[model samples]
Target: MFMVYVSETQPLVDFLRSIKNGSTVLMASYDEPATKLSEEARNLIAEMGSTYVKSLGFRDNWVFVGAKALPVKLCLFQHIKNNDKTNVYENWPEIIDMDGCIPKHME
Candidate 1:
């Protein structure tokens, strides 16, 4: 498992593409993850099993678990908190916490 705080798109996209099959990826948002995020990056992450990647917006809190080249059913864990425009908190959404076990990948 690897943890990443997305701030840039190219580096993250490159890293996501380079990962080997079955590799687990953990992602968390910090500051503004969408300012520099590209459509390609969002599509790639969505393909990797993130349902919320496409809707991720500015200052939204997001956490996701995914795996390279794996079935979506095997790696589908995510949590998202959209920034509340009417009642903003510290210019960002509330933080999220998640805990679970990812089944070991078999060859």
Candidate 2:
């Protein structure tokens, strides 16, 4: 199952509006400052001795922009750290459909 975990400060709202859920999404690169809450999410993962998030980039840093109307399978996970430290990152993924997000030209 894939998700589009949104945080307090999602940057690509307008861009995302162009796509539809269940669509095939492309993982565009992102390297911008994230919310303090988002950073804490990455830190939590790091503290657990996992380097996956580092390669995944900052929490909520990357947004789903482009898409292909192919039958490709993709699962997007929204991971974030919080002061609660309740280990809530394990079972939360807001699903985002990407099949319709694909550009017309690409189809």
Candidate 3:
């Protein structure tokens, strides 16, 4: 699953084009004027299909605006990290140190 935030159509199209078929995408943006699309964006997304649709309300800052969308076959784990680490990151039940790096399995 991929999470993306976009303001225009071409970038969204590029994002869709980059992903393989059967991939799932999660898209979010500030609620537009109830008429956000400029006809072209709507058409582009329509051609893309509902398998890639996910509209959301406004967020203070978009965390990942241009990352490649993820494949649907794999499960995805994603969350917004708190800008200030005085508290825990939003996705965590346990605490994460601000400057800690653990070894990855691939490494």
Candidate 4:
């Protein structure tokens, strides 16, 4: 699986366009405030023929379109609102490998 940090739609669209037919994409993001992705991101993802996962309430741990075992060509994207302190996903060791103040949800 590939990992791509999605802060905008261009990169996402570029990656999607590069994918082969019948291939799968697995995406992950930290719904941070800085992420400026528009609704077109979702629309393009769907248009590119990739599945979208609805993984809410899991904080930093989520899958794209709720797909299992995301394909090898999958990508993970994220945008942090506050880059100075710590990312919301930073506390989740299993997801993000960063040493910083752990969020309460992780504790």
Tens digit of lDDT per residue, candidate 4, span 10-104?
A: 66556666766544444555543113444555555645333432222223444342122333333333322333245443543234432333112
lDDT by residue (1-107, candidate 1, tens digit) is 22234444677778778989888878877766665678988888877788888887766777888887876445545555564664357566656768888878886
Candidate 1 residue pairs in backbone clash = none
Candidate 3 segments exceeding 4 Å error: 1-8, 47-107
Q: Which is the winner by lDDT between candidate 1 and candidate 4?
A: 1
lDDT of 4: 0.40
* Reference-based lDDT, each prediction: 0.71, 0.37, 0.34, 0.40
List clashing residue pairs in candidate 3: none
Backbone-clash count (model 1): 0
lDDT of residue 32 for candidate 3 = 31
Per-residue C-alpha lDDT of model 3 across residues 1-70, encoded as one tens digit per residue: 2223335556655656676644443433332311334445444443434322233122322111122232
TM-score of 4: 0.38
Scored by TM-score, the top model is 1
Ten consecutive residues with minimal summed lDDT in candidate 3? 56-65
Q: Tell me the TM-score of model 3.
A: 0.30
lDDT of 2 by residue, 6-65 (tens): 444233333434455444544522323243324554443333233444555333333333
On the 0 to 100 scale, the lDDT of residue 4 in model 4 is: 33
Error of 1 at 11 (Å): 1.9
For model 1 the local lDDT of residue 6 reads 41
Which portions of model 2 show Cα errors greater than 4 Å?
1-11, 36-73, 76-107
lDDT score at residue 31, model 3, on the 0-100 scale? 23
